[model samples]
Target: MPHQLAVTIRAALPAARVAEVSELLAEAGRKGVAGELFPFAEVTGVHFARLLVVPEGPPGADGAPVPASVVYMSEVDAPLQSHLTDLVRKAGEGLEKVFGHCDGYPTGSASVAARTAWLRAHRIPSAAFYVNTVGRGRQQILREARLREAIEEFLDQQGAALSGAPPSRIRAAVQEHVRGRPDLAWARSRPAPPALWWRIRQKAHLVALPVVALFLLPLLLFALPVWAVLLRLHELRDAPGRDRPDRRHLRELAACEDFGAQNPFTAVGSVKPGRFRRATLTAVLLVVDYGVRHFFNRGDLTGVKTIHFARWLFIDDKRRVLFASNYDGSLESYMDDFIDKVAWGLNAVFSNGLGYPRTRWLVLGGAKDELAFKNYLRCHQLPTHVWYSAYDDLTTATIDTNARIRAGLFADLGPAATRAWLALL
Candidate 1:
C-alpha cells in the first residue's frame, strides 16, 4: 500500500526554492520523524514514508531527458483515502510547501478538498508491489512486538523456577503472566480477520490468471518464437551499463545509509526503445504482480525475506521506471541476496532497461554479470531525502517471530508443537 506521488517541478521555479526543499527534508530525515510543517507520524497507519527529488535521469533511447520531479511515497494500511484525509488535515501546510514547487499545485490558500484532489490527480499507480506480510497492520505489529518483549522479560525473571518444565507448562505460565498484566490485555482477543472484499479480490486474481492463460494459449504459441528472436537480437546489440557511479553521488547516498536497521533505496532509469522491450517488460511485471499477490503473501519473496515493502512504478509514459524498496540490513547484503538468490528475477524485469547488463532468454546472464549489474544499479541510484519507519528497530524476521509468539501465547499444543512454539521465544 505504498502511494507514489510524482509531480514535476515547474521549469520557472528559481533554484533557491529547490535547495530549500532539500534542506527541509534533510532536517526531517536526520530527526527520523515528522517536522513541524509535516507531522507524518500524526497520520495514522503509516509504516514507512519518504520524500525525495529525482533529478533528470539518463536520456531515453530517443535522446530525451526525463524532467526532474518530486516524489512522495508512503506505505500505509488499506482504505488509503482515510490516510490521505488525515495527511491533508494534519500536514496541509507542509504539503503545500513541498509540492508548491511543482507544477499544477494549488495556491497556498487553496481549500483542503482542493489540495487533496490535486494530490490524487498527481498520484502514480505502482506497476507492482510487495509486502512482507499481507495481513499485518501497523498497530498489530507494534502490539505484537511489545508482547514479545514482555514475554522475554518474564522468561528471564522466572528461568530458575521454570527450569526443565514441559513446554506446555512453560507456555501456560507465560499465558498466566500475560493475563495478569492489564497493559497486555488486548492480545486476549483474536485479531480481526481480513475484510471479505480483499479475500475475494485475491482469490479472483489467482483464478483469473489460468483462465486468461488458457484463453491466450494459441496466441502465445505463435508469439513465443517471435518474442524469443526479438529478445535475443536486442540482447546482443544493447550496450551493458558498466561505468562506476560518480564519487560525489556515492558520498551523498552513503550519508543517508547505515543510520538504522532499515534503509530506503530509490533508483530510476530509462526503458529500452521500441514495442518489443516495452511489451516484454509489461508482461514480466504482470506475472511478477500475480505471484506476489498470491504465492508470496506469507513472508518470503522467492526465498528472500528481508524486505519490508517494495514497489515499482512507471514514469514518463513508460519511458522510465522508478524502483523503491524499504529493506533490512546493509545495502551490500541486500544486493548480494538479490544476486545470489533472485538473479533471474532481476534479469526478467531489469533486462528491459536501456543500458542493463545483457540478458539471455529474459531471465539469465543479466544480473549474473555481477560487476556490470552493480554498476548499472549504482549509476541510476538516487539518494533519499527523507526516510521514515514506524518500527525501524525491528526487521522482517523479528516481526515474523513476534507474530508467531503472540499467536501461540494462548493456544493448546502437544509436547512437540509446544517445544517448537517455545523455541520461538
Candidate 2:
C-alpha cells in the first residue's frame, strides 16, 4: 500500500542544516499537511501531496536528529520510483516552500538542479525498501490470531537475516528468499469500486446537512473564542522534543541495560487487501484515534527515545497494511519487547484487516492465546531493512534543528494535525 524511497544526499551541507533542509523538503507541496507552522513554512496548507520523511532520523552533532541522508517516503497510490525522485528534486529546489528563505545554504534552484543531476548520475548507493499488496481480506486477516503469528515470525526472520548487515546484503537476501513470491511485487493500488448504497445514504444527508448547519450557527459564532483559549493553553505545554532540551535518549543509550546493543534497523511489512466493509471500519478507527494519539505523545515521547523508535502505520482503502518502524536494539531484545508489550496490542487494533501475522502480529492476545508467535521466531536470524541504518541516532533528537521554535507555532492546528506531524518524527 505504501511505496517507499530513501536517498542519501552526501551534500556539502552540514548535518544540522541538512536536517533542517530535509524537514523543509518533506514539508514542501503538502498543501494539505494539517500541522501548524509559520504560515510562511506552508505546512498547514492542505493539498494532495505524498512523501514525508519517515521518522526523521540520523542524529547529527549535539543530539540533533540529522539523518544520514534525506529520505522521501510516501504512501501514494502512484508508482513512487517514477516520480518520487522528481518530487524530491523539486522539494530541494524550492527553499521558500519549506522554510522562509534561500539564505544560509547553497540550495538555490540552479544548485538544486545540479544536485538532482548529480544524484541521477551517481545513482543511489544503498536503500532499503519493503512493500506488498494489501490483501482482499486484509482487515479480517488482521483480526485472525493464527495468521498473525506466522507473519511476525516471518518478519523477525527477515530482520535477523540482515541485521547489522549492509544494504546490499538485504537486497541480495530478500530478493533470493522471496524469489518465488509474486505477492510482494510492486503493483498499483486497488481500483475504485462501483458505487454502493453508502453513496445514496450520503446524498440523503444533503437536506439534513443544511438543518444541522443552521442548528450549529450559534456554536460557530463562539468557535473562535473557544479556539483562542485552547490555542493559548496549547502554548503553555512543553515544546517538542526536537530541541533535545535534555537528551534522555542519549543518556538511555549510554546506560542501555542490554548487552551488546544492536545497530539501527528498519522493519517494514504489509498485509493483503480486504473487502470494503473492513476498509470502512478501519477508516473510522483511524479517524477516531487521530486526535487521541496526538495528545498523549507530545515529545520524542519524553524518554522513549532510549529505544530510538521511528515508526508509522498505513492502512489504505483496500485494507492494505503498511507498517514501517525502526529501533536501536538487537533482534533478540526488539523481538522480546514486541512479544511482551506490543504483540497483543498489534493484533487488537493496528492489524485492522491486514490479516493474521501480516496484519495481527505476535497473535499473543492473552494468556489463552497460543504461543505460536514464539514458535515462528528464529532468534538466530536477523531482521534488517533494505538499508539498515548503522547510524544509531539516525532519527534521534538534535539541538541544531530549529523544530522547537516552530513547534509552538503549530500548536493551534489541534490534536489531529499534531498527531500527523508526530508520525513524521
Per-residue lDDT over 1-425 for candidate 1, one digit per residue giving the tens place of the 0 to 100 score: 22222222122233556677777777766675545767777888888887787666556668866556677888888776677778789888877777888777886678778877777777888888888888788889999999999999999999999999987788999999999999999888777767778788778989999999999999999999998998889888888876789899888889889888999988998898888888889889989888887888787999889998888888877888889999999988999999999999999999999889988888989888888988898888988867778899999999999988888778666788889999998
Candidate number of the best lDDT: 1
TM-score of each: 0.92, 0.29
- 21-93: candidate 2 lDDT, tens digit per residue: 5545434323323222222123211111222223323233366653333232222222324343454444453
Give the TM-score (vs. native) of candidate 1: 0.92
Count of steric clashes across candidates, in order = 0, 46
The models' CA-based lDDT, in order, is 0.82, 0.34
Q: Give me the runs in candidate 1 sitting further than 4 Å from their true place.
A: 1-17, 30-37, 57-65
Candidate 1 global CA lDDT score: 0.82
